[model samples]
Target: MRLKFQFGSFITFIGFILSSLIVTLDLEAQTHQFKLIDEETNRPIPDANFFYGNEQGISSESGDITINFQPTITLTISHLQYGKRSFTAEELDQALKKHQLALQPKSHNLQPVTFISIHPNAGEQEQMTLQVQDKLAHDAGQVLEQFSSISSIRKSGAYGFDPVLRGFKYDQINLVIDGSQCATAACPNRMDPASSQVPLNMIVEAEVMKGPYSLRYGNAFGGTINFKSADPSFTDKANLNGRMGTSFETNGEISRSEALLGITSKHADIKLFGSLSTGNDYTDGDGVKIPANFYRSNIGGKIGLKLNSTQTMSLQVSNNYGKDVDFPALPMDLRKDDTWLINLGHKAVFYRGALSSWSTTMYATKVDHLMDNADKELNPRMVDANTSAKTNNAGGRTELRFDFDDDWLYAGTDMRIENADGTRKRNMLMGPMAGKTLTDNVWQDARIRKNGLFAEYHSQGDNFHLVFSGRLELNHAEAQNPDAGFAANYTDMSSDIVSPALSIGGTRTVTDNFSIGLWLGSAQRSGSLAERYINYFPIGLDPYEMIGNPELKPETNNQADLIFNYKSDATDLNLNLFSSFLNNHISSEIRKDLSPKMATAPGVRQFVNVDKAKIMGFEASWKQIINRKIQQVAELAYTHGQNTTSDEALPEIPPMEFRYRLIGSFINKKLRTELNFRHAFEQNRIAKSYGETKTPAFNVLDIKASYLIVQNLNVAASLQNIFDEAYYEHLSRSVRNAESRPIYSPGRSFYFSLSYRF
Candidate 1:
């Protein structure tokens, strides 16, 4: 076997030499000066990859690259957002002389952030730039709602939309901000999820990992959402910069304003930013007003010090506050929410020896939440209930990466501590208990601590790449209140979970334009605080109460994926097929039995462990340049899931969806217009035991246009749902009444935006 491996390596080296010689002979003395820019904006496209023969390098900040190669040699230029493009040496020379070498950007809606392993297959990583995100999502609240694979569950109209990815949501998915875990929601009903805390404008980029194939992030059973916030940029000398902008929307009379300021020096840098937004009740397509009023404000800053050329330390702090929020799906409204976050980090780099780099990070978060039914229209016999809660999260992580010949290893340790304490007070009005006040601890000082050690190994070969990772974690949780009405069913509330994570995948390049890849992985996720210890909490959007089971076991998933990619000068295609089998799956079961203390509850359910379950899905995307002035793109996604243990379909699974976009650029590519058509098939498969309902099919059309008025001034206009169709997503919540009709989406509205950079 060793001899055969050696022979294969020798043959590969020979083929490489022969290919280089053939290219060298084609052009004995040829030099190409290349300049890459955005086709639409004509701005420099930085950090783009360029390759010719065996020589490769990344484009500079100015998007300029000068290369000496054969006249017939092919040059490849690839980027995460722009897709991949190639040009011949002669074509490059002509473009350079004519000043027309620019990479055409793919429609942002169709791009997919994927994981692949080899040559032409692992060429690109998809992500949305800050500029694109800013244009699409006007407010921070709309950020996650724009993701293609994500569907928002709106307990409130537009305030807190929890993102569900591939039929998994909330604690089932891992949400990380700058490689660190944030605090969980303070509200028992999860009025505010983790993604709500990070303001949209503050994010520089967001990358979504579709499945558990990659485990660098912690306990990603369904997937991972990684958000990167804007940081201070380095400067040669002292410099100062800042920006301010404002916008208004017609549907809800929404108003928003934001500003950022930064000062940078050779050794130190500082940044400060803030935003404020307010909106009134939004009307539906039928002109019926929904009680969705909200107000939000946040302020944050960061300071960095350069200890040396290769070492740095930084400190960051942020605070967020919300007031007078209304939720139509629940019985209560949010009165106030105050949250604070702090992080301190250090990073260092080494140029020589086996050690490549190391980084350390520590972060803390605290949330104070208050809610009540004082502002809502309630029954005369109902009680006026008020709830207040506080949650704290703190953690630290340190990782070291080692590099050797053709191989790399990462070793790290991470720890997280979380605690929840809250209480609810009710006042009776006309009953025998009128004028009386009743108080109870909602969570009773519940505390959970998790510690983990992990390591990952990777290797590179001529035609195949390999990745493997493992992790061990310990979890302990307890609550102060042992009363029967509370979480008193604790027979040993501690579990030393030895969770193992592994992924093995590689790509085989069949040709320059085609590749095939396969990946297999196993991931495990322990139960969350709400799933394991909460006595009574409302599941967001769903009409059910959640009861905890302290003895519930962790969930494990073994998954497999296959990938196919095709890239050419005018076309890009990607398709993925994936499947997962889960063991000890945690799901909620409706309960009819009620104790004396719970007899008055509206809806009742308990968390339980299932023996087995399975899910399978596929995603496909295609992009083509129909002409020099037109582009066409299409994407399709669907997921099928089942609970074999209960012989039923999984609840809350999204239906089959597809999107088609037609983009046109004219006037020397300065002006752009887009017409998009979106469609969703009716969801007929649902778990009847969970009271899941079937939805009807719907189609919607949207039109948008943007133009650059001047060098620093830009304007954009959009007409959403041009026909004013009244429709609702499958995951939308129902009204908190006897009728329980699902909430409808917004009506047709005209939106316009303008901004100027100074």
Candidate 2:
């Protein structure tokens, strides 16, 4: 009986071992699949080198190369200039099965040989410029304050982001966030739909296209700023991530807490980002308390799917709410402002041969806003004034690129439809005394439709390169208002513009450490709605009001720019110079003594088409890797603008500025610190309508430090306005009161953040 039991135990042990081996073999047989792509354009990459253990693989010629391997094999993907990327066997298997892997292209060698490469977000290619990541800010209003070009940032009582870009306010420049355009209607007070609704922390990056090179964005006469958010990452594996932070200021106001939560998996990725911030009224540098206390709350979510190797679909929804936000410069304060956003998009790429590579995207957006005046009793002019506004936009874009041997060519088409509607009502106390006890209610409705087509060709060789490109656009606009008390009937304003763009540039390597490049280019832009049909009250100008012209024609501009770049292993420098000439330039001018009813006033401002204008500027930037532990960077920008029609300085031109930065890293890459300083030459040549006084120049300082507390944890702290400067920025608006109260920026402030990943 003992012998029989022993035999049975031995047989059972052998069977169990065999079963375990079979399961291991089956798991190893499961293959992992993945696709690599360009981060900027979402295009697949080809001819990339991939390695696993001792095995090597290369991408296919069509940029759609695939790799298959066991779940336990460690993998690495790399290219000459791009940094190397490594993934564990399990991670690769998960990503391949789910299809959510993307790689950033190497930038050092990616510069086009024959074409003046322009990124979709970065307007026209003028010179090398630094792009800022939006995640550095806690809110939209705070994000704009980080840029040098922006002088003042404010939140309307209605909870919108109102920014003064290079001294130009309200409608002078075009703002685009995730392919959506914002519209202003109601009250002419611009109380709602402020840039603040889009939280800065949600933005991935912001590209500022300086000058008129951004004609494609809209009728932007000044420039275009495109705020892009981070794309969702989808991988075969399931992962979760979250972030939390807090901030404080010296003005006795404690900010509320904020946090973010997100998750990604092979089948789908979902992200929920939100923040709740509240603070009491802040005091200025001199201990003078400003009554503009504010609180804000925002939430954003995105759902993304990996449809297949060549396709992706995504849906995004976001909302922002603000309350009791005050503006010292405005006559009235904002009581409540709300913004809602919804976006859906699809991206795909098709390849047929050496000559067929194309990409397409379509999207739509809607914006709604409402605003009411606070302190109405103190400001009788706004006692009974309120405004409500809505804007809708839809657009589609397609591009086809072909490559042949050493030559390449591309063509693209884009179309967009935009509609804006709003209403403003005045209370009985604010009724016009001279006019019929004005129950003034103004309604404005307008439509803008545009279509554009463009093409470019390039040929590159070892010693030389050449490129040519052109674009033609057709625009149609119509505005109707039943209430004549505010706007006139500008039935239809249409034009077909063929704005040809050309660029020629070449590079020659003179030595092992130096190279020379020369470039020249030109572009054109049309007028925007604000310059066309704006007829509203002027808050900045004491006694004058602004009226739009219905008969205004399209403005045209011609520009040329040159750039020089030099680089070595440790140091790099870039210099640029550009000039632009505009014809039929649209500007607001005051007609002296034109209105008999207001004869005692200075004059009335009206939008008019000027005969000519010119702008010239230069930018220089240098970066030095100094040593293994330290790096330094410096930049300078100067712009000079003039109205040739009147032979005077332009009203809202940016001022000369200088920036310096130093970064230090210690304990390998574990601890880092940065110091930044900026100086601006005050803009003295202010437009009459802008203000009655000139702004003084000032200097500002900022500091940041970060430490990796552990493998997956990081802590950071930052200080802005380190010196507690009391001067107002040139971009700040002036109140209409006799005291001319200028909006003062926050004195000194501090913020701390913590992030963890698992």
Candidate 3:
């Protein structure tokens, strides 16, 4: 009896042990871990929010998180102002084993969330985007000029305004309207493009990305500007919104009026935006007439469809007509520029087990334009010398992202195609002989296509973070011209090019209030068709018709930057230093022996692979809240560049500048007022590459006042260039042999606006 009892006890003990082991295995399968890191610096972020099961969870003090999953588990990670991310059990396991997982921060705009997220800076160091309400409720140029990075603003003599960013001019910068590429053929002289299509009153917001970081938009060697129109907000309870405003400026003799109407439902939304502006020549600071006068009209429409919870599509079209646009810098002016643009895009998101989340978009655009000489000097001689040009572009980009738990990693690929065509006709009076007529036309009927693939990886630990990213791009270009005369002038060309880029950055946090970040990157750009095949008349730089250079090579640049940030509840300060080295910089230079009128003369201004160039700059900005009713934002920037081989100052470099803004609000924020001051140091180090023109320095002041009329209505007014100081941008191109040639900015202007929300 004793032996039998002992046997039964042993069997029971073994069974218990087996069951315990099986339960432990099941719990291990349900467990997961994650680490949160800063996007730019790749440093660990402590106390972030991590969610699993159906409820939100908290990260540990060391930026680490572990979760015991429930059945049908889903894991989500989120931080303040950063975009939220989530993953399924299968996706989490794959990401952890690969040791690569990352979540992108939210974009500046909250609506139409984007997957290609950039991290947010702490405190005042963060880049801020003006909301639609802010834009529609303020003066366009006045609001844009508030950013310290922008150095110059020129009213296009017509109704619109031209903004020169950093130092880049003309087509070197890319412009997008409603997320679609707007094509403009009006830049034959590199004067006006799609950026001029939208009046300030019609724009809901404009986002400018400085430097080569703009490659994602197009072949934007310098930068990219994106103009967004107001869309129906999902957060609004009502389905309709309407707004109207009017303003008059004394300096430019300008009168502007605009209106916007929008309708929204749960699934479908439509909007109509339009503006009308007219102005006459205005007097300068000294009461001298500047010959800056013109009239313009613009209209745009947008239609959007929300197909489902994760998919949306939109279509937009716009038209702009301008007459007698004048330019102080050029001898002959823009007589007429009629532009039209059409764009369409669709965005969607999908979730697939291990693949996680992905967002994709497809877009296309078309543009047409016509231009004529409008200067008083040319009108007396030529009567009419007009030119017309057109461009058509079609492209699409797709990006895929995968997130993991161990180390953050993201990868994507992009592709694009563009085509352009241009023509010019000359009508010369020739001493009343009914004017001799000459016509020249050029066509780029072929396609230029580009394909790129890229990947980025990030790792976050307790004290430090690291990131690595690389991209490879391939380009195929072909040009076809049907006009024999134009074809002979510009030889048919075809080429295949490849470019590669890499970036590495890291960050470390020494304490709770201080942190440092370092970044190094290299990028390359292939020449554009305009740079390689354009052979046309350049009105601004006379005694010379310009021709293209087919032998030009690609341009490359290497850059490094460092940033330090300090933060507190009431005050924030940031400092950054950066440097870049460019190789084979492609710039136009005159041929020494060519005569002034060889149809391609004034010495051929061909694009050449010039010597090396270097640029270095530093930027510092601070924001402080003096009290509950008062705050201040101040910024200072200095930049310098040189052409190493020529030992000459580089053309189109931003001068030293400073900006300050003071804000005061009262009556429980019902009333707000802001004061702005800006100063730019004289740019004496002028380059003689094109001409011996020197730009002077100046200072200006502005003020804005706003009053909330009701819960949905607001009234605001602004005064720009308050001091009416006379100034000219250093980068403005001058007409050859013109004594008074600098592009004069508007002297002083005042604007009043009213906004109403549904």
Number of clashing residue pairs, candidate 2: 10
**For this target, which candidate reaches the highest lDDT against the unseen true structure?**
1
Residue 241, model 2: lDDT of 67
TM-scores, each model vs. reference = 0.83, 0.77, 0.78
Candidate 2 lDDT over residue span 1-758, tens digit each: 63353234334433432332211111233334455656644444654556666445454322443444655777786653344679887777666665545676432332221111111121111111112113333355445655544543342211344565544446545667653434333324554434665655556456565444334344344455666665556655788865555555445464655556778887677888777766666655666566656767778888877665544566777776766666555545666666666665444433334533444444455556555554533533423555565665556555556655456666766666555566555454433543322332322455555666767665654433445555566766556543464343345443444444444444444444444545444554444444554445443334455555555666665655555666676777766666767788778777564451222235567677889987777777788998988999898877677888787777656578899999887775677788999888877765554444677788879898777677645677778788887766554555435665665666777766565433
Query: Model 3, poorest ten-residue lDDT window?
Result: 109-118
What's each prediction's clash count? 0, 10, 8
Single out the weakest 10-residue window by summed lDDT for candidate 2: 123-132
**For model 1, what is the error of residue 607's alpha carbon versus the real structure, in angstroms, after optimal superposition?**
1.0
Candidate 1: regions farther than 4 A off: 1-141, 540-542, 596-600
Candidate whose TM-score is highest:
1
TM-score, cand. 2 vs. native? 0.77
Ranked by lDDT, the better of candidates 2 and 3 is 3
> Of the candidates numbered 1 and 3, which has the greater lDDT value?
1
Task: For candidate 1, give the lDDT of residue 686.
Answer: 88
